[model samples]
Target: MPNHDQLPTDEERDMLRGSVRGFLGQHIAGARTVDAGRQTERQLWKQLANLGLTALGTDPGQGGLREVVIVQEELGRAGCGSPLLSAALLNLSGVVEQANDERVAAVLAGMHTGDHCIPLAFGEFDGDRSAGRPALRSDRLTGDIAFVEGAEGATHFAVFTAGPVLTIVDADAPGVMIEAATAMHLGGQSRVRFADAPTVRVPLNKDGVDNLVAIARLGYAARAYGAARRAFELAVAYAKERKQFGQAIGRFQAIQHKLANCHIDLQGVELTIGSAAKQYDAGARDWHWFAAAACVLAGDALRQVSLETHHTFGAIGYSEEHEAPRHFKRIHLDVLRHGGARPARDELADRFLGGTPDRLPEYDLGPAANEFRGEVRAWLLEHWSGERRAAHQQPPFAEREYDRAFALDLGRTGWIGLAWRKHFGGQERSAFEQLALMEEMERAEAPRAGAPVQAAMLQVYGTPEQRRKYLPEILNGKAIYGMGYSEPDSGSDLASLRTRAVRDGDHYVINGQKIWTTTYWGEYMLLAARTNPDSKPAHAGISMFIVPMDTPGITIQTSTTMYGGTFANVFYDNVKVPAANMVGDEGNGWKVLTGALATERGFIGGGIVLKVAHAFELLCTYLRGVETDGKPMRLDPIVRQKIGDLAARIESGRQMMLYCAKQVDSGETPPHDAAASKVYSGELMERFGEVALDILGLEATLTEGSPGAILRGRIEQNLRHSLMWVISIGTNEIQRSIIAQRGLGLPR
Candidate 1:
């Protein structure tokens, strides 16, 4: 299977996107109009045929659903209407399935050449029962089909009946009447009434119908994503250029955060659609699930993004003449097609609440990593399950998250430093392999292991002696390092830290205090102190040292967190550290500090999301078996919808995590991308906790040991724990600034 984690960089795909975008740029002017008339629409259809877009998915060499997605996105981006989705993809799909039939072959040929506009009229109108599926009796059709897109100027109609049969009928056949219908958007939709109209059977079976429907859903979702993307781009541009209060509005934190959210939302829609399409092309059996997920997220995300875009554009965008309004209409209309998000949500709810592999869709993390994931999973089952896991969980909740003996055991397997260089006693595994390890460990709810950040720093900047002393201890899980960077007054603003270190002979005398040190009980502290107080910039005078926590004159005052975890305010009153303990040159600690912090932030992003995913799974398990007022909670429509939404968002967060991991594998620091991941994932955790409580009610708020507490009170504990994720590891507000400035190039 293709590496869907990476952005599409193939020359052919790039050329295809570029050519389609270029065509739309030149031919389509202003906001698209549905009243362009049938002749103009046909002319545009012929142009698309010449571009080979209509031939997509018909031949393996030409392209498949992936290519079709690209064309659909471009069409949506331009706010241009086309027959690509209805005639080219949907109708063509039916004809291709029955290509052995001479009549079907003739229609397929005409479709490919753009000489025929054959719209597929399948299923009932979403949420409207006025028009229902046609019936097939004795090779004739009689019924009314509604919302048949691309029905204007059509030469034929591919009607799917309740008999599970696909039949082709001439548009002008006797007793067949097509009337223009008012639609939510400008697409040429019509209602067709058939009175025993003779039909030609297309030989499509049940599987064929399923396949076509999945593709149609994905196609509509792709278009919605494209429209949302275009609207976001326009809003960003306007924010950059439109001035307010003597500066670009983009400089305002309010505006910046809004656009930042839109960026993240767009990523979710784009990645989900791409994943579904790629999986379909690879012939994965679960592609239908992904398609449903894509549609669900697209429908919800685009609607919000559309509204936000207009809000950013203000009064000007409210006008129908603005380009933004066109995109708004297009997004709403497209996503609402093909049964909308409700049916898709129901499909997801079935898989999640049903007893069959009750988990979210698995991502394809490439072959090597996929194999490694299974290996890690099996290893966890052996080492962390049954009596061993039960014994570990017997401890207090906060302490159970870490176990020295278990960490040492895992370290012995040589997986602790999987991504470290071989020179540093590591296996030198790929980043993907490391990601697999992280995922499996989190899913297994295993205790945290490895001192990855410290090991990484020691490898990059440690002296030979320092490496010899710390590397083995870290790799063997014999040592843990606590970060001593945040002082009471210098949390996110690390440069303002006042901690001082003065040289005295061969030792540095350290004096200051660090607050919120969660790992204060660890063996050593990664300390940052000011060496030259009078330097041009305060941070320019900072230096880093690895100070032993047992050093004299150091004091630790511990306190319990609201979530029952312990952290300390550690004070250093003239503590002495050996000069040799210092890593990197003096006054360059900023680089070293940021380097380690970046890695931590990336993992923090992934870790938080995995926690959310696991918690969501537990909630689903509870709902599956629990009853409310004599009814199963799983049967509740509101409950199902809520679960389905969370499931889709969780999948999106997983994709974002993988995207960041791919960036790391490419040997780039990717600070902004990591920040995006961290911000989105962290906030998602908070949202999940709130939604869980809302879904499960007061019983969910009971403490862990309380009687009748849901999920053993994990839901409430997690809700409290979630507050720390967003606040620690750099606040979500700070991360948003990073995304706005670094990712979007917005003014600070």
Candidate 2:
């Protein structure tokens, strides 16, 4: 609660992370490339055993559940193939969950020892079974369960029987044929076949299907999170190192702002996976739907990170050796292998329409979610009219001034500190309120810049003086601030930043280079620097300084992104700041940062970014104007499909975004909801960019300033800018780790 930067506290999270990370480090990290695309990694399994990664799903009498989930996450990270998924689902839980046999315990034991691997296979294309009728001996799962992962080494198969039944079989048995490992996305995960495999009988009636689906969905969600984390990490690392125009890609306002957006998305991902995992652990049931949602977000996150990491890396990332292609491939496989994002839609539709509607997770927004809706609606009606709508319609994401205003308005309305305690500029809102407010903002397309997150941090750790000085400035629209955290040499390893501030009587004279300062144009900046580098720990010696832009000896050098505009490189040469301007006690910067980032479940995917909307609008307008390939480009199935997919992603993203908002509104974090949504929304934007360029063909090659440039080359600009969204923030890869580690209690 102290900070968004504060790390997770659960011991299960740390232990799981260490165990799985150790396993990957020992086995797959340096494995030879047995095959270019498809690796039949036999030696890899024993290593997983040596590190005790395979038996994670077993009850504590054997090992731990958290460990197994971490293994799933690691599997995605390493892009290493393993059949432990099968063991956990089918042999360990699925088939036994239905049968009353001692074999269940034996299989569970085998799984713990890595004696056998088990996997389950059921798909959207698994042929329709006649309702309430017997599964024909010949029906035999007539459709291919495409992109099935972990079946290669599965000792037993748990096949989804029609309705609520599970049919189990030995993978090595007659009628079950193991096919050569096939290539998909990521690297080694594979797909195999039934080809009329004989069924293991499940009686006509049973209810293990739900359990079976949960195991599979949750596993994939973990995998997705892992992949997303790697993608995000790669993006962030790439942004920090990759130079563009004349400086690191990070030192551009457009890039830094985009990265801020990316960070929000990553926070969302952490919330989703963590929430879903908690539910699973609680035996909350309905893990099927919960895990489904997590996967949807994970897929979204993975796709977004993969695309952006490549963009951030440019040509280097595009080449096969860069690891970007493999990560992208993994995203596609994990998403499509299951019913894809469509199932999430079906699940949501079913939750809202199938049940008593009133029974859908009683969103206890304290004042019921609808109550806040009514109140906000009343407030809007009383306040928002022609002038207000006109003023607000300037597109929240694009209007810098309005963005600050939105934050001020929300602060005035007491919505900005919805989650903080009433004692300190907050309403002490519940998780539901926080989530609800976020959803409301998204729905209203409200701007959120003035609040700048640092306000929340101040509430947690700011001295009374700091609060009095800055909170009002933030709440009102008087002061705008930039995050001057990263410097020339420090990015991910932020503790090592080199900026310095020396004590000088009533002030501290600071001098150093600060790059990647977002919105350097802002009036005030939150600068993290070293006040005592000789102090024992690097983290402890740091301090936060609130320096006014007008301070003497400060030169802000601007760097343009591949897009446009700048994130400035700030040079503080003996710039004096009063000692009173410090945020808290000196040598407490890291502590303050930790407090700031704790429980930071938030927006995933960039805000309904204007860049994406602009791209879509432009593509639509272009499609209407001309024909391509002998037919209007708008009419082609591929074009239509891309558009259709984007629309679905957009809509789903909106809901997930709202869901994330709901969690935030109630004063509860929304990690799983946020991560998945952010991932999906960001990726969808990239997808739109790629599809738009393909449709534009040569037209996209033109620069905006060129004589014959097409539509001022907006598509090209968007393509270039989209990379920033994925690379900034947590990077999709880091997001996945959060999901896997914090969300699912998986091994890191």
Candidate 3:
């Protein structure tokens, strides 16, 4: 009985974020300036209670899990320890909603008035917290529970016992001993010993135990995310100000790449947390899967960002005076606090592997979008068979007629320009629909709809005349475009090209040699050349035009690529193009080119994510069926760990792509985010291919047509094609610079 529509509006979330940020700044500024060991002041906790944050999520209008998370993140960023998460979110959240126990109800009611603080101690050394363990108990409980958060501040302890019961015990009750333990983070913990302590067992079931643990795990994840975010910001600031050889370290490729990775990790944590919160708000029973996923991924991210940020700061970060160690310590504690990575991975794998194959986490595009995905999937399953995939899968960087033919077939259905306006021969679909199309096409390994993509770009920056001349043919699947931006000298730096186009009455004569052009099969070349050679900045005076592929003086020499694909070294010797073919007014090509570049980066990135997902699935499926030494390879401990890690990373990239698409749909131009997606996914492709090959061993090296070639040698083929992902669409290195400068607000 999940309410799929229960998500908060963007405006409402923004307002909540602003108010929480403002509150933390006003009350916690002086506190953060001090060391991490000091506890959150009682006055500040009272102020939080006064604002009703402790009680905000109990009612629909007051907010829900998402609102609580929003407040938690800001509090964590401030390094403040008010026990809001441990006392309110973890201990009292579901209890207030589900139970009628008088003591529980009284504790919950008093929590909002800052008169009570109850800490959860469900974890024991021997048993799963959700499934209670054996303890010294006849009528009272006796055992030691480890890592009980907020233990030092608790007035009472909510302990889970062998009865799978939630027992409420006074902190100072007979036989109770609380040994204080030092934490690396802001909060305090204790080893709570119950030597036959008097206890009140509340009515609770197995489901209730699991729900409590899930709440605790998720709330801890929010705090970890905030700490990691702060760490990344600190790193970026240090990189910009800390001088290395001569310039700021942020200008160096090494630092930029690492910081960029930090950003990617933080993004994954944010998205996963948001998804889990929404699931909880909607009353989804499957919310536990998301909670587990978030904890595992967020833990790794927090650990990674903390380490990298510390590295970026050098020795100063290791000092007690710096804030980096505090965040670092907190990340270590949180990562291991709630069952750690191993157990979480096992939980996720059980859902995906032990049950139905359909348990694999696919993007839930809502009911309408799911219907659209089904329609598209059905069409693809019918049309794109094994044979079609083989025929169109002509490695990376190749342009095949078979691919174009398939695209033309899709274009006929009005699916090619789904994101374009309806009047422009498009369906005017939602971004989610477009994303669904991209993901399905990638999963099927179908022919890329590249030609129609250029047509869609034309809809954005093309002149009306240009659209009228070329769009119809493209819409009807007639014309395809080859890019003409990169020259022999320019790669990612597209503005420094030496190609020149001079006006000659009604035509412009073009002379340039373009390298790495993959659109040789297209009907037209979307060319970029300089019209004013003397313009102050090299980027200015650039012009874009549509040149006929069959124009007299044009020559295309094909070069074989490393990945078994082909690139066209297109040369133009005094080629003439009509003035009407120019995309925009003279000197406006830079704007047009950069705009198109952003779109291309965004969409190209979408495919890479799905490709990684497909590769991971293929690896899992192969290992599941095949055996070594009469045992399934999937059963090997090392193999399981490797695949589990890969699965998490792949899903992370998938979430990143979806978020970028959402930004585009909202009419925000996020070039940096688009670049981040490309950067993370491109490198991820390389890593996945490497790890998969390693796992599959020597037989995986055989090429297609070999007797025992695995997946028809697609694994080896992917190893070579992975380079194209990192190098093409803008090199991963270039994308890192974009992320550092634009996304992190660092200098170029």
Which candidate number maximizes TM-score?
A: 1
**Top candidate by lDDT:** 1
lDDT of 1 by residue, 564-634 (tens): 78899999999999999999999989889989889888767877898898889888988888899998888
Provide the overall lDDT of each model, using Cα atoms, as 2-decimal numbers. 0.83, 0.59, 0.75
Q: After superposition, how far is residue 343 of candidate 3 from its true place, in Å?
A: 1.5
Model 1 earns a TM-score of 0.95
Query: Candidate 1 at residue 433, lDDT?
Result: 85
Report the candidate with higher TM-score, 1 versus 2: 1
Candidate 2: regions farther than 4 A off:
1-9, 30-43, 46-69, 91-97, 102-105, 123-146, 185-207, 242-265, 283-292, 318-321, 350-748
Off by over 4 Å in 3: 1-8, 29-45, 88-93, 97-101, 125-136, 185-187, 242-248, 386-401, 450-453
Model 3 TM-score on a 0 to 1 scale: 0.92
Per-model TM values vs. the true structure: 0.95, 0.51, 0.92
Question: Model 2, range 466-499, lDDT digits (tens) per residue?
Answer: 8988887776655777878877678756789889
Residue pair clashes in candidate 3: none
Please write out the lDDT profile of model 3 over residues 266-354, one tens digit for every residue: 99888878888877777776777777788778767778888889889999987767777777776676666667666667666655444
Winner of 2 and 3 under TM-score = 3
Q: What is the C-alpha RMSD of each candidate to the true structure, in Å?
A: 2.6, 11.9, 3.1
Which order, best to worst by TM-score?
1, 3, 2
